[model samples]
Target: MADASAGRAGAAEEAGPSIRTLLLLAIPALLIGIASAVVLWLLDLVSGWLESAIWDGLPHAIGITSDNPWWILVVLTFTGFAVGLVVWLVPGHGGPDSATTGLSSPPPPIGTLPSIGIVVLISLAGGVSLGPENPIIAINGALAVAAFARFATKIPPLLIITLATSGTIGALFGTPVAAALVLTGTVAAVRNGGSLWDKLFLPVAAAAAGAETMHLLGGQTIAFHLPPYGTPNPIDFLTGLLVAAFSAGIGILAAFLFPYLHAGFHALRHPVLLTTAGGLLLGLLGIVGGPITLFKGLEQTGELLAHPGDYSAGMLAVFVIVKVVALLVAASSGFRGGRVFPAVFIGVAIGLLGHAVIPGIPLGLAVACGALGIVLVETRDGWIALFLGVALTGDLTLLSTLCVIVLPVWLLVTKAPHFEIEPKHGLARPPTALA
Candidate 1:
């Protein structure tokens, strides 16, 4: 018995970070978390101020509202040209093209951070339809890695990336649970000997700090005031499944169109022209979809929820279609942003449409299922999709249903092409000016 106990102790000690090491790691994790939240908060604050100035102050001064078609066109086109100049003339070319990357792409070189920050702010303030997730994650990850490499030389780069990624996600979602859920599959797949929770310890700690800090900083919450989803029935399940499948199909279709759009835009062969044309198209889309379809879609989601009666079934359908195309264009045309936020908006629109068409489905359930399906396709992570579905509606009753709905949706997208662009030869660089 004594020998067995000693053997077990030895094995356990070898399996994971010791308590002391964990404690040491926790210090930096907390710091990184707090820093990440502050960075996100600052970026949002500046962007919000800029967005207001451009859309409100400038437009009013010019004797036109922001929603005027000409104003939208001019601002968006100029935004593209400005962003293009940054990519063309600025160093590091605003990091890698956002279309070719995902939420967890490798950190860009430290030098690229400035240009990335510039372009992301422009996209946000200019009413581009993409989210800040991808670029912000890249920025934070690169900074964390560089800082740790300089000061804490012993820490691995990959660990820094994980911590920063978790912290940023926590800040974005206003909860550490989001970070944990999003990272579960990746963490579980590692060939490490420690328990999964043990492996998750530092990242979760960072996420917790990030979430709390962001909350203190007055970051907007992701939840909505939708009607509750009560008991589920067989018919509800059938309708929910259909809604989820339909929404996922939309995302899958967008994914199918991604590469072709990316290739066509790249064929323009100059960042200035490609992004300018891209922004022009987005302006046209905005005109058709209205002001509600603009920006990253978070604020727009709130608007849609606050006055559901204002939009008809047809308008809701139009919102879905327009936003999907907008997301494709923004992502494919060298705009620096993430696809997740716009996708969430698309999902919400689809859900509203389903409810309007059926009238029998609960609003909360429809929205949750719709978000689940489209987010699943955009993120390719069941956990994130499930989290967003519940988070957006703030209803736990839909959890089991979403879990079931995600299965078939996952199977449908599992074999489909991902919503990312791959370079035909080697890694595709940002397009430079034509000689």
Candidate 2:
């Protein structure tokens, strides 16, 4: 009995990866991580560059600073141009399926990368209320798969997939914790797929390597700081639950609007036309919402957190409406990016709404808290969303504690139907003469 136990321990110890194996996997993962960061950073840079060029050229554009009644026409026209180009020139660049694409899917993107990248950038830089995370992730996943297959002598298919998934973990939403949540979910999925516990090491290594690489390369993500808070009381719990209820509605709205907006612009399909039109709409809304609603809301989230009460009741209402409309316009118009940032923004709006309704709570904090709560509700990925909320507020205690409070309600929201889609292409055919 002693010998058997000893033998099992020996095997387990050996079965687990050593520092050496970690380094081996880390080397490749580091490369992939660096690549993801570079690509992400470049994508942002491109959007910034485009915005500057566009604005410089058209300073007097009517919709540039305010919502004109004709703003809808402008959005339609620009999107029509984009859709025309995508359908006419780009053969299979369907971009991404925002309407239906949810999280999770089968291995590796085979096609639909450049189109996705282009679309996201166009939307974000064109002053749309979105960020460039999700599309970038899918693209990164594809790149990792391609690289894995090219190197490593017949690396087991499962290992290749795990490695690819891991490569993006550290770079998840531009934070290590975000990467951990994503990779942890991925690991859960893999474990469920088969009795392949050994494969987890590969992804762990890849994620570590990727994160370390991002650190080395100075690929810092955008800054957000959630505030600190005291332990939740019944009041906090009830408030969070209420916010979750609203957030579920927000998620559904986001899901539906995301697709409808895409279809709206796709109806036109001209790049310049779609972009110009979307820009015009956003610009016009910017007139009332100010520049805050015109571009990706990432930069302004912090400002909102800092002075939530400064915004008037009328202004908050307009801000919420413009952001929702702008997200639809940008996402639907073939712009490339994720709606996560915009979703967070919506959460803030909801939080503010909550305080407004109640009349006694710290309205600014309430708005921020509600915003953070809704993120947990929408993504069904709590810790990272929690982190994002905290980061947004620049107050960790407040955000983290709020995260704890909101967790129960957010988990309840998991029962809500999420939007999901499969990859654009079907799997490769097996050999004709094969078994």
Candidate 3:
């Protein structure tokens, strides 16, 4: 027994990272962090430039107004054609289905990076109502793996993935803490013989580096100014609970509809035809919802929050409904992007409606709770949902209220199907005899 115990102890000690080893790992992690942030920044810049050229410059130079609905429709439909062509012609089928993917999935082959990057850039530039989180993470992960394999052969691919993802999360949210919060459940679930903090050391280092770099570069976060929550009251708590539950219910409804929508798009059976049709429909939705409802909802969300009084209850309701449909269309219609940004926009609209209806509830609480509800349903992570609520409001006061509201919301969605598409299964075809 003593020999066995000593042997186990020796194994544990060997498994633990030495200080010198940690320092070496931190150098590569920091480099990966900087590289990830730069890639994201470049994507944003390129997408913005392309979107401007397509949506504004082209129309202006051609003596047509982009404001006209017909122009918007034509451009988006053409965008569909372009993306469809790429997907059909490019190997790897334009990467995995975003509808079936999470924020981070297993990276595709290194060879697929170029095609995926092109499609994602086009989608972002063409006003697809999705964020770049998933593809950007995939790109960074793949690149990190390739680079490490070439030079640092001892680094495991899984560790590379974790570092890259952490860096990207930090860059995305403008804070290292966001990565830590998102990764907590994952790290805790691992049965590795180390303390939780010990396991988090490299990831946290990478995240901090990414976040600081983004900060230095003026990265955007989900920030908005809202009236403060003056005091904690039962009335406010009850209102938050009700509002969160209601928004969660809406998210659940979307969850139920997701598969049907995905199948409907896939039923077309070819990337070109399916995407073109999807684009035309998305263009129509853009017309109905106007410019605010068109894109991934990050800038539009800020715009909506900037002028809260400009919208009536009816108008706010329309915004919510239209954005939700647009999000569903974007996700289902072969457009590759993350759903969380649009979901945040929908949650904001819902909160605005709540405030409009019940003037008594604090606006900050209403918005935060609404975000908490929908984000919980969308991401299925309480920490993330709560973080989003607090981040969106730029108020620490919403934290406690949001934490409490998440409990009931989780219960409501615990057994529900996630916002993911199931992988299709089929037997492989036999090879034909050579001529």
Candidate 4:
């Protein structure tokens, strides 16, 4: 009896954290979630205010409208210069080259958070085409790690990373579900002795808290009220597959171009020149694609969906192309941001184009598949791709159809290079040449 009891205790210890331990961890996880959401909310609040001041107030104060081509050019160029100055002069150089970082990359030193925050805000407010997700995650993760190190000395750094990442993802997407799906692969890869959900407990708790906090704070939803996808038909499957595959192909092409673009821009050998040149190119693209093609693209996705009838097939194609280029430029040119949001916009445009070209396919299905393919290629996470696809449409009915569609899309993208740049040196150092 004594031997058996000892054996049971050992097994339980190896099985992972006990229920009591997990429950205790949940408390801190919840707090982390709330804090994470607040950080995101604050960033959005300040960025939105600054965005309005630049695009609305300043434009109105000036003689020309905000959308004027020259004004767009000047604003973007100036934005690049300002961001470059921060990178060139500011300590921490804005937390590594955004091009070379992933959404869940290890957090930069806590001291760098301020410069990262500044560049992110400038990029966001100045109509740079990247989203706040990457930098915000880093910022939140660093803060969480620092706080834990100071206050909860016993908490492991890896666990802190998971909690912070889950929290921020939940807040960004307005749902804990997104956090769960995004982290599924990571958690499952661990060879620990816990049930998957058991391993996920703390992270999920943090994600839920973050998501709910964001909701209570009135964060915008990613879903749009499109016509529901009621039933899946044979033709719908074929169409969905095609759209997904097509979007994946486009994403792959962009991925192929990404490294070249990074190299070309970095060849400028100066942060200010590279970013300013990038801004000029973005300005020209904006003039061609107009204001709708600029920015992180969440609001523009809604606008595009709200008035889908106003755009033609050709124009929709323009939106996709221009946004793709803008995403590449913003990312490769030292701007601090994420690719997912702009990729979402591109997927939406591609879907709309499919619908316009082939009126037989349901808008919701096309859009979902489009987003799935692009997101799958970018993030290389099928679960997240599927979640965003269904979440964007807010239709559970498409889940089965999307599950099928994603298989071939996955096959299409599985072999493609990921949409990330691997820096030649440590963390893509700032170019040495000042000019």
State the local distance difference test value for candidate 2. 0.58
Model 2: what TM-score?
A: 0.75
Q: List the residue pairs that clash in candidate 4.
A: none
Error of 4 at 323 (Å): 0.4
Candidate 4: where is the Cα deviation over 4 Å? 1-14, 426-435
State the lDDT of candidate 4 residue by residue for 1-435, as single tens digits.
Answer: 999999998788658768899999999999999999999999999999999999889989887788999989988999999999999999988987878877778788999999999999999999999999989989998999999999999998878888898899999999999988877777777664667888788889999999999999988779888888997889999988889999999999999999999999999989899889988888888999999998999999999989888999999999999999999999999899999999999999999988988759999998998899999999999999999999888899999999999988888888899898886666633221100
Q: Quickly count the clashes in candidate 4.
A: 0
Counted clashes in each candidate structure: 0, 57, 0, 0
Give lDDT: candidate 1, residue 137: 91
**In model 3, what lDDT does residue 143 have?**
94
Residues 243-346 of candidate 3: C-alpha lDDT, one tens digit per residue:
88888888998988999998999999899897888888878888888878877788888988898889999988888887888788778888788888888999
Runs of candidate 2 exceeding 4 Å displacement: 1-19, 60-80, 102-112, 154-169, 192-222, 225-227, 230-234, 256-290, 328-335, 355-368, 421-435
User: What's model 2's lDDT at 124?
Assistant: 59
* Candidate 1 local distance difference test against the native: 0.90
Whole-model Cα lDDT of every candidate shown, in order: 0.90, 0.58, 0.83, 0.90
lDDT of 2 by residue, 1-435 (tens): 999999988777546456586667667656666676666667767877876655443444543532343443354345435543553466445455453343333232556776676666656555567676566666776676677678765555445544544555465444455555554554554322322334345555566666666666656454554344555556665665576566556666665555556667667655556656666666566666766666667667656756766877677677777777777666665555566777777677667667667655554356556666556544667666666655555555466456556656666566764433223465332111100
- Residue pair clashes in candidate 3: none
Where does candidate 1 stray beyond 4 Å?
Answer: 1-10, 423-435
**Residue 324 alpha-carbon offset, candidate 2, angstroms:** 2.8
TM-scores of the candidates are: 0.95, 0.75, 0.94, 0.96
Cα deviation at 173, candidate 2, in Å, is 3.5
Query: Which structure is stronger by TM-score: 1 or 2?
Result: 1
